[model samples]
Target: MERTLSVLAAYIQPSPYGAEGVSLNHGLHFTGGEPFLNVDLLLKGIELARKFGIPSLFVETNAFWCRDDDDTRSTMRQLKDAGLQGMLVSVNPFILETVPFERTFRAIQIGSEIFDQKLMVYQTDYFMQFSRLGITDRLPLQEYVSRVGLEEATSRIELLPIGRTAYTLGEWYQHYPATTFFRGTCRAELQRNYHNHWDNYGNILPGFCAGIALGNVLEQPRIYEEGLDLEVYPILRILLDTGVRGLCAYAQKRFGYQEREAGYISQCHLCLDIRTHIVRQAQEFRELRPVEFYTQLGRDVPADQD
Candidate 1:
């Protein structure tokens, strides 16, 4: 992965992300095999990011998985003490359906107390309510990506894993998958078109994976298009272009070595309260580029120990 990251860094010109010379206005998020699962590494990465002066560190994690993550929890607390901001928790009603609510909520409670608006809960989708998306009849990939930002539209994204990864609550192991992320591939971030996106690790892809939308993040050179858009709508376009400036690829791998299909690659579902025609464009949105963050208790959070 490190080699791949280095390769990616060398691929783009002027550089798209990181503390490098090109750009630094935007921030980066780190999430994976349960961040707390590797507290030391997580903390190390946080520390390095802090050194880079990253404004925020968004850590999306399953709080239930952290119930026993005392060391990592303590490390996270220390990062908070060191001024690292934002900790987004993936909490849904179905959480208790598999793990003990009390256990997961406990870590969340601690995390909530430590983080501020930085703390958020995923109460929709496979996390809780909501069902499958309309595959038979749906918007074009680009158009759909533009729509996932609405508060009302949140419930409509019935995401299953990308290629073959099934998204059923019954499967406790898989959280979010890479295939799910491939949905956003054609955005010029991954491939130019579904055809070009073929091949993975070393294998040649056959065709579009089920519910899979292939291609890179942006298809062709997007500079001219971005420049023109920026001139017309400065505020929104600035964010759209700048928010993801220094970032590498944003992928969510739910399966193990097999690379299963995941859900919610961009975390656009994280924040969509604001309004805009391109509200869920994700390329540049608060949920995707939160400038400020605070995490507090949910409505009926339990009191801490005496």
Candidate 2:
């Protein structure tokens, strides 16, 4: 890990989007609505990786305002000083009202104090979700007063690029593994699958998934026996043994991270809170997690501000 961070840091600050976000290591992605909002927290994560020598850090963000902010500028400077590398910028316009061009242009114009700007990946799902595809399209949001809605729309735009590590990668991306285990469509089936896993739900559980977990009870009807559990440790060993690493709580003594069940942001609740949770994880983290055990991540993240 130290070797990876050392070499990568020599080049420039990490950009966890585009080529940067797509990891050959753990391929894990941390996503968020406004990851850069917590600049101090993020820098800490970068510093830790640099200290421990984790290769290629990816942070996803929907808000470009951070890179555009002075504090973030200093944060980047600090990361450079601290010797961290690998950043992925998610260029999804809907979430980040600004575009990558604006940031790049500013960085170039702003001079040397600025960090490097590299485009790794672009996403399209946010637009699809906002368009007629998501609950917002068919629900109350669509019914919002047009004049007011138009005002809101006119102000928010997805024009900036940001880190893929904006949100916690592991917990957010576990849908794949969870779904692979729970194949059926019914709530009971999903419940049964999750039930077999030895973990119970938490109060401050990620809001995005909780709503879905609760919703699944009504939407799908299924359950796994109470005696079983997901092979988190065994499965993790395979992933680690195979060289996978990302930003989440698979193994950590100092930081509190748990591999909980996943629920779609559409179905679960605490969206913004989840972002906060990961920020805290990156903040109060006391233990060190190997970078090779991370898995599951993508260009998908909110492009606009949180």
Candidate 3:
């Protein structure tokens, strides 16, 4: 916490969005394998952020622990007391298989009572859920929305074509032509530079899916003074200038990266595949940090696994 504060104090500048009621100059978020898995620690972090005068504290949870209404309400009350301002509940097909929708519904009911409009539901590409689950288009959208009590006005988050999603779910989506695939710019990278994501180990990433590491929080002064130079990070610079295909070609020439004959589903799919290949073959690329972010295929584990 001290290291992060020092880094923010030294390097971060207030942007236009930092106006009084607009957004926090520094915000803290707790996300993970499941934040509510360690509710005690989650509460402590929120309390610490409040102590530091950090304006916004949010948590993203699968709501797997929201098994019973009374238990769920009790847990949320504790978090709200500890300065938790918002809760992002994961309500989608992946979590639905193990956690009943009713559990999430109960959570939303309790959360709305506490956080009001601050409570929100996040789902990854609702249309893709149909493809994965074999649900037909004739299925009314309200049928799914009614289950969660979320209206159409709720936000929709796109599933990035990275990690396991790239390998498994990417195949299900129709691919764009090669020329068009590389044309998209990374809006996440360009938009928010003030806020960064700090992992459990203090590794700071520019964005969640962006594999490039600015540096670890423990080395605060040096990294802050030097700042994050996109030019120093070869892959990020190439991605900004040439997009995904340029990165594919760079990886092929420098690291002997191989591409699938079927091509990529999106720019992120190609970028992730290149990073996965680089990180696996060479230790130097470990500077990208949080190796698991680039390597772990999400959720679809083999049945033979323990």
Candidate 4:
């Protein structure tokens, strides 16, 4: 798999339109359902990355397999030895339901000992009230870290209003008025950061919340050299330029799209609604790529078009 990736990387790097002078040396992150689940593959992938002269390799996991301290220690030792530069353990109320906090705490302890400063915790502020487990106050990240004696390893982030959350957990937070659209910018795209996400199928996305695909790494590189073409992607360009309001206007004018009476929770909610409408109305919107992402937002495309 490494050889295949190298060949693909090589193919794009030298091409006139590919990203030249950029190699795996930038960085690579292994994330998904749970990276630690496939320890062998994870280790081999890291080893291959090192062999290819990649500078850094990181892994993100829910720490579900940290039931045994000795086993966790052994796994962390092996990963560290295989050039795993860092590890991120997800700790929150959602994960705490199935996997006890004790197990996650043990993983953090062992990971910190092995990976040293390279170990960190990734957390979100959206914690549901799991009455069965008596988890009411959300996972107190700082308190938990203090208890574990690793207060410096915790990083909290805001929950993005995308995917299932846009429909399910969206009501938990207050949304901006529809008139406030276009007041914000997409920091991820503007920053053009090196950290990119790749799913199991190798689809490279700009960010976790932004479902816009830059093309699959396993295949030819589309935005490798020149970067994403906002103009080519009409939806994204409008969103970037005019924000969700612009897209809403475009949808209304182009496809006669309608807005909900309740308004939107955020720009993401409005964007998803427009995309969902376009997807259901015409097949041409497939140019957006990763059509399944917009279609799976829990809202169905209407059968009839006006």
Candidate 5:
């Protein structure tokens, strides 16, 4: 994990987006299932970013650990002293569905006091809306949608119709044939300099296309410098040349993958479903990484795994 961060820091150049809102284009931002879940690791990463001179360093969280005033204050102080520049607190209808609003409220309240202007509330608009709605604790997504109306609820969320979202929220979105989402090749998304992620498992997830790996940094440390060989990353090469439609075709012929009868919500939705099917089949594809993603999504697989 430390080596991956070091390698990434060397290649990650500062961009104009650095001055903008909390975009990953800026620099090393620790994110997670929840960064606060492992405080020691989070602190180590923050300190390492500082050591490597990585700019715009911060950590994102769902604020589930803001249990009390003392805990929040102590943790924030410890992180600040460890060289964390700021923090982003995530809030949305989906987060509210499970995480109590009081926890988020406490995070914002204490975060402002500690990090001051450096603290960012992602989608601060939603925070305001929840506050205005008198949401004090946990609220189901359906109930929130019902209270605010579907259109309004949809407008407030910064949702991407991929992963489990496409399946769980498909009812609220328009579905189209897989071909309809084949807007263009994925070369741009795969090669873009922004919003890339290198997980602890060493998989490089470009453009937040989780479950798909451009390559593993730990195994191919020179990937960023030498570039990926198309032959080595066949799945990535397919997406790079022909887009999701091509992937769908390839999966169909090679893995007997069938398109969902119900259709898809977005190009990413189709891509994720195809990749999930391929992972379930257990045919080795270097790009379909972190097989645990499929398991977490309720897909069955052979017992022994990564």
Candidate 6:
């Protein structure tokens, strides 16, 4: 954790793009499946970031563990005291399906009091809609949609057509054959500097592209010191040079991979499906680190299915 923060602290600088870089604010944000699950580790991370003078430190959570006022307040205060600048409570239908709405409401209510303007609700739209519904307990997403109307719900939600959503929510989207999205390369996405993530295992996830590891901070601490080399990452090179289509072709030839006849919702979906196949085949690709991501997704649903 310290090494990753150290490297990140030295790497990021004040944006020279001025107002254009507003969305690309350089900050260390702690997020996960849910950061609050391990309060001790979360506090330690905040302290380490502060020790390195990393500004705008914050944590994002689903508030699944915010069971009561006292525990919630204590944990929020503890994080603040440990150098957390802000908190974002996730308020969406998916989270509301598993975590009670009361917990999210409590988190936002208490977090606002604690962090003030720094307490951000990721999708205030859903929060407001859910609030209007007067739901206090956990509700299934289908129930929420049934009440709100599918079109209305779909229009309001910012559902990214990637990861598990590509499978679970595929019915709502138009599916295209793998070759349909072969127009562009992944150079821009792979080379993106802003909003990238370094996972717990020190694997650098460029452009929030999970499962794809640019390099490990622990193994190749200075991997990107001189910029990315295509030669070093042959798989990444194919992705950059020819996009998911190239990757599809390579995987098909090498691993006897097959594209879904049912098709994909987006290039990312296709890419994920292909990568998941590669991971399941036990093929070793250094760029495809954190194999558990694929395993977990596979456990959830078959990536190749629509």
RMSD list, candidates in order:
18.7, 16.1, 6.7, 7.7, 3.6, 2.8
Residues 213-242, candidate 5, lDDT per residue (tens digit)? 888889988887788888987999899899
Highest lDDT model number: 6
Instruction: Give the poorly placed runs of model 3, Cα more than 4 Å off.
Output: 5-26, 123-157, 176-191, 194-196, 208-210, 221-225, 229-232, 298-306
Model 1 residue 90 CA deviation (Å) reads: 0.9
- The Cα RMSD of model 3 versus the native structure comes to 6.7
RMSD of 6: 2.8
lDDT of 5 at 205: 88
lDDT string, candidate 1, 1-306, tens digits: 232222223223321333332221124445543676676766776666555455434566766455456754775688676545666666443333444544545555676777744565554343332224322221343343344443343344443323112222213233443233333222342223222211112121112321122211232223223323334433334224432221112211211112212332232221111111122222343222212111111111111111
Error of 5 at 289 (Å): 0.7
Q: Which ten residues in a row have the lowest lDDT in candidate 3?
A: 297-306
Pairwise lDDT winner, candidates 4 and 5: 5
lDDT of 6 by residue, 210-283 (tens): 78988788787777676666687788999988999899999999878888989889999989888888888875
lDDT of the structure predicted as candidate 5: 0.82
lDDT over C-alpha atoms for residue 163 of model 3:
58
Candidate 6: clashing pairs of residues: none
Quote model 1's TM-score: 0.38
Steric clash count of candidate 4: 0
Residue range with the least summed lDDT across 10 consecutive positions in model 4: 12-21
Model 5: what TM-score? Answer: 0.92
TM-score head-to-head 1 vs 6, winner: 6
